[model samples]
Target: MTEIHPTAIVEDGAVIGENVRIGPYSIVGPDVKLADGVTLEAHVAVAGHTSIGAGSHIFPFASIGHKPQDLKFAGEVTELIIGANNQIREHVTMNPGTEGGGGVTRVGDNCLFMVGAHVGHDCQVGNHAILANNATLAGHVELADFVILGGLSAVRQWSRIGTGAIVGGMTGVEFDVIPYGSVIGDRARLAGLNLIGLKRKNLPREQIHALRAAYRALFENEEGTLRSRAEALAAEQSDQPLVKTVTDFILEKDDRRFCTPRSED
Candidate 1:
């Protein structure tokens, strides 16, 4: 039982699933696919090769699956693949991928894109990610599971936000963030491990303790280079993936540097 409003324009080739609801004045393009239980409120426009997964709810005026904003885009076939149960809020814009960015922008299940949020071309967003009001990701950013970006924050292109990491409000993230890391500042700097996030996840206390110790050994110590310290730390705490995730993230080679704490902090 699909409900499409009289003023809503669903193109002939669009795929509408059972129990889907398209509200007044909405437009669904020929290539769009709305899965079962999907709801699009009034004045929404879904275009390009986009697929709204089952149980996803999109509020008013969202521009989903639009063409990539990249200056280099030139009519290539790309897709925006959104997973199930996503909540895309008002004025949010999620663009499709470009050819150079692997031809797809993929978002995992249960992500929350708050009002005025924007997901640029070729971004990869993992499950349970949260982008607070006006948070924006530049093209090609990767956000791991449970990553939280606070209000008015912006992530630089090609930056990777690791699992359970939290970016504070008004921050500008220009580099990679380790798993469970907490970063804050106008220009983002690593503050410490996301202890609260770990606790919320109900991770064992001992594991949390190991991760904290490793964090101190890597960042607080003054003996050697950060990379060397990360290597030793990773080896020492190899048994705990929680600790190793931070170390391994530090050791990985990338164009951008990992966020580090300020000298005063």
Candidate 2:
């Protein structure tokens, strides 16, 4: 039951799944595969080795699986794999991986990429992520589950955003953000825990309190280095899993700078 508009151009070798809709003037390349219930609205261009998962709705003017913007890309066989039930909005651009970045870009399920958002080559986006209008991720960036990037925010290359983090609008993130961290600044600085996001998940109040305590200890306590503070927190026996999530994220082996609170004094 695949439906293709009369004006659409689906290449001869394209593999379109059942109940997929290809709209007016859209182009599906030979190596592209649209899974079950995928809807490609008018003027969408899906090129390169791209396979969009089932039930994803790609809006008009979206450029999926396009060539990587990296100058080092040399026409290698790369891929962009988008997960299920994503909402890709108008003018969003998602590029495939280059040889330098393991040759594949992966986006997890239930993502909402807003208008003009860009997912750069080899970026790994986890489930329940939301990129607001004009939000951008540079090459090889990683976003964990429940991460939200506000409108006009941009994450620098190779930074990792942890689960339950919220990046504020117009912020430029140059460092790795810890889980449940709320960041906002001209250049992103740790604001606090993402309490709104945690509450939206219906997380228990005590658990959130524990996370907040851990945040203060790790970022505000003028005792030890961030990793040392995190390690000390990890040694504590706590019933709150979210606290451990933040601590473990800090303890992870990444050389990137950790986003921290601006000096209050």
Candidate 3:
């Protein structure tokens, strides 16, 4: 049985799954689909062609599935697909994709979108990602699994943050961040490997050691382009998955400059 407050307005075509609870004054639009165990606190608005997966809890004042903020959007039918068990905090705003892009904004499971966080249209957020308070992603940005954006961090449009990467508070990332990378500072230079994160995950010590060596070989090799070093590391550390992750990200072709340590210059 779904529990909907009398003050809430659930449109006729909206699909409400069992065990869902909608609080006072919340509005579920006609095209919205809320799966089982979803809890919408008061004053939340879920609109557009949005499908929020099971076990998701949305706090008050969240504006979800809104139209894209892009100027080219002309009322096209786009969608926002949020996976299961996400905790969307107060004042968070998530927009649907734009037709100019892929027409879909996808967020993976177990994400924590903190208060005032914003996910722009067409952004793809991976599982277990954490967006700290006011963290923002511009359109078409991709965040791999286990990535964390510290408070007030923002990623520029079309930039990709690889798996296990962390961007520190108040930083603006305009480049692609490598996997297991830690970046900080304004305009965000890569600080180093995410050693603490790897340790907490209990990756084998040997693998970690290999990753450290690979990092140095890839970044410290001042004689060649990053692509060349990445290719060399790929050949040398084929057995080390973590090392391969870093190298593969370097090999990815994108317009944004790769984030590198400050000392690289």
Per-residue error at 199 for model 1, in Å?
A: 0.7
1-265 in candidate 2: lDDT tens per residue? 8899999999999999999999999999999999999999999999999999999999999999989999999999999999999999999999999999999999999999999999999999999999999999999999999999999999999999999999999999999999989999989999888888899999988888888888888877888677778888999935569988887777788464788996421
- Candidates in order: C-alpha RMSD to true structure: 1.7, 1.7, 1.3
**What is candidate 1's lDDT per residue for 94-149, written digit by digit as tens?**
99999999889999999999999999999999999999999999999999999999
lDDT of 3 by residue, 1-265 (tens): 7899999999999999999999999999999999999999999999999999999999999999988899999999999999999999999999999998899999999999999999999999999999999999999999999999999999999999999999999999988899999999988998898888899999999999999898888777786777878888898888999998888787777344778985432
State every prediction's TM-score relative to the real structure: 0.97, 0.97, 0.97
lDDT assessment of candidate 3: 0.93
Give each model's clash number: 0, 0, 0
Rank candidates, lDDT, best first. Answer: 3, 2, 1
After TM-score superposition, the amount by which residue 28's alpha carbon in candidate 1 deviates from its true location, in angstroms, is 0.5
What is each predicted model's overall lDDT from 0 to 1?
0.92, 0.93, 0.93
Which residue segments of model 1 deviate by more than 4 Å? 263-265
Off by over 4 Å in 2: 263-265
Worst 10 residues of 1 by lDDT: 256-265
